[model samples]
Target: MTIATLFAAVVRAKPITGFIVEDDPDRPQLARSIGLLHLTMMGVGATIGTGIFVALTTAVPEAGPAVTLSFVIAGITAALTALCYAELASAVPVAGSSYSYAYATLGELPAFLIGACLLLEYGVSCSAIAVGWGQYLNELLAITTGWHIPDALARPPGNGGVVNLPAILLIGMCLILLLRGAKESATANTVLVFAKLAVLALFVGIAIAHFSAANFHPFAPKGMVGIGTAASSIFFSYIGIDAVSTAGEEVENPRRNLPLAIILSLLIVTAAYILVSIAAIGAQPWTAFAGQEAGLAVILHNLTGAAWPAVLLALGAMASIFSVTLVVLYGQTRILYAMSRDGLLPKLFQRVDGRRGVPRQNSYIVAAGVALLAAVFPLDVLVNLTSMGTLIAFAAVSIGVILLRRSRPDLPRGYRVPLFPILPIVSAGFCAYLIVGLPADTYALFAVWIAAACVIYFGYSIHRSALA
Candidate 1:
């Protein structure tokens, strides 16, 4: 109970030998089925969903016409952490992403804490992404049928509706695809990612065609504070970039492909986000971005003064949300599977289908939990929560990079973080800065979640951990 004892207890880490060396005969194995292209699509699938599709409506109002700069700021933060992610993911090549990396570097207790953060990140993010699907689906329906879903069924109760049925249904579809197996899920994600990207390209093309210089006047109306706040807010859109690491066990030539996918996906999404932000701001006044549902589709509808283009964008948004949710849900299940294999949770989480090679029970549990959140919470509530969890996990990854470099310098790595300690330290600093900028309520909720996780860890995980 003394300080020295407590410090030592928390720092008791696992050996940095193998990510797949579990002695548990019953532990499920993941097939090495994902390649560079599919893994990059997984990253794109996990990101580029609701952020550009829906988060813009919220972020643009904060930074005014300067929102594109907000994308740059957030992208830099994400890229820093991603570089750290790439290094750890390459060397570790495990299912838990940051959690596994933390275990390898920061010890069992810290790893459990990071694992808790990821549980919150992936679970809430999957739901948050799905919640916007209803809005876009309604948009598509309204344009084609002259009618849309009633608010009670389309929006969450927090948004002045009873439940979000479309979001639940979207989660249901993802559940089916995930249970089929990893390769099938990744294949579908690749197709969906391309479809959504093309749709975004169409959006940017239209926005530029109608670009007005008037909208760019008085850029940064709210100045530095506003831009920083908006960057912190929109960073939620970039949450799933680490998802590439979650597929470590399933990636082919993981040391090479894992880092490659992580970096490639970040570059691709960062460019897409920045381009779309500029185009949207150019096409319309930043003041007009607030409180719009299916905002991209709405922008097209207003710009072109037609319904067909909006409907087309709405269809794309649906595809984006579905792909994002599917991949995030997949990430969540893999995380639980990893934790369970390490004896952090119940064995049920690690149980897999003998034929399909996925943690079947884990998928069903994660889908049901995400569906409930999507059905009940408003998009705004879940968005900040997801960001909060991801920020902490990101900071952990950066710190993990530093810790592992000192502890295991001889370890073979497929990728080395450019500039070494400087980048990782800066990455952690950026994540901390954004964490400080989040709303007070977000901090309070995150504290409560962490407290709950500590309780579970002390009461259950610490006693059952494989390293114990």
Candidate 2:
């Protein structure tokens, strides 16, 4: 093909009007049972899990007592993206999440690319959450029964151990719960969110009792570079702030409820994360954070010289991480199901069980993929992969908000971002900066994933797409 022809083919945009018009009669319809309350709980459920509970072991060592500042930086970046997400979710109100927004605003190629990135955001996140669950589950067992899973079976292969059985089992259990249906899943998630918040509140209440000023002496021991690096790593904790947007189709009165839930969920999650970080650092010196598998539980055990408090924290981690895995896994399946219906993926993914009103086959496929990664890979590798995918998706959504405003000025929007182009510009810029902060090896892996996605699209999906 000539250069002109190739460039024209690649940059051509999908029609805004046609893409937004629903046409497929056989397309699976999700039950629209979620309210503002359920949506808010889901966002909280997805956000508060493994990221805070398991990530500190690495983040604290990087920034010392300044880890609190790292949380602030990450929260700002996430808030920017959340604003963009809210505006788009209110306008689009669809099932495919950001992928659907990109199709309506950007084009087919961009939508396909963003869909590829979401595989990492949700799939790898489930793996990371499951790994954390394994660590906390073992800790809880040891504290109460004086016995734990053998290290050889508890840790992943990359951690110099055999397959992580507990992580695999955790994914399997979530898969079963998901197959039961969405309403049941949402109810379970709501309960889990409250239980998680209560446990963290308990931890803060107890830890502050033993707060020490000595831990704050050299707060930024590693300097600004360390804080930036820690903030980039800590960004993983905020991944689920967009979970509310993913359920736009199911959310009641989506226009108003979607944006409200997104904003409210962010505020609640940010406060919880900041309070936990402060209490943790105050309770114990930051230098001792490194290499501790279950950092929070270890801190409580060391502080009180008692097993009960640590066991309580461990129980909370297990419940919280399990909920995270369930919600993230659900997000992955729904995104793929949307793609399948659009003829961009195999149709098998689009099939939903008529009676159960759930995508049963899709759940099984996601479960197997998530369980394999959780069973073999180390936590750090899964975490960086998840963060990279989310940062890219966030940048795309910010850009989409700008494009849609220009292309469809006549469209009605229930929620408009406060500072039109500036918020999106800053959101996209910070997302790019965080992506750059990731290790070179991670960038290489991301490049490979994108290239693979391109090959798949050009070889099969492009010709088969419903748009074609």
Kindly report which residue pairs in candidate 1 clash with one another.
Answer: none
User: What's the number of clashes in each of the models?
Assistant: 0, 0
Q: Rate the local accuracy (lDDT) of all candidates.
A: 0.90, 0.86
What is the C-alpha local distance difference test score of candidate 1? 0.90
Candidate 2's error at 425, in angstroms?
0.5
Task: Give one digit per residue, the lDDT tens place, for model 1 in 1-468.
Answer: 578866776788878765757544665478899999999999998999877999999998888988888899999999999899989998888899989999988888889989999999999988888889999999899888989999999999879799999999999999999999999999999999999999999999999999988899999898988899988888878866778899988999999999899899999999999999999888888888889889999999988889888988999999999999999999999999989988999999988898999999899889999999999998888988998999999999999999999988999999999998899999999999888878999989999999999999888887787776
Pick by lDDT: which candidate is best? Answer: 1
CA shift at 40, candidate 2, in angstroms? Answer: 0.6
TM-score of each: 0.98, 0.97
Q: Residue by residue across 1-468, what tens digits does model 2's lDDT show?
A: 577855554455656555356545575577778888888888889999876799999999999999899899888999999999988888888777888888777778788899999888888888988989989998998889989999789989878679999999999988889998887888899898999898899889889999998998799999988898888887877877656777766678988998889889999999999999999999999988898888888888988999988988999988899888888888888899878877899988988887777889999999999999999999888888888989988999999999989988777788888898999999999998888778877788889999999999888887778776
lDDT of model 2 at position 133: 93
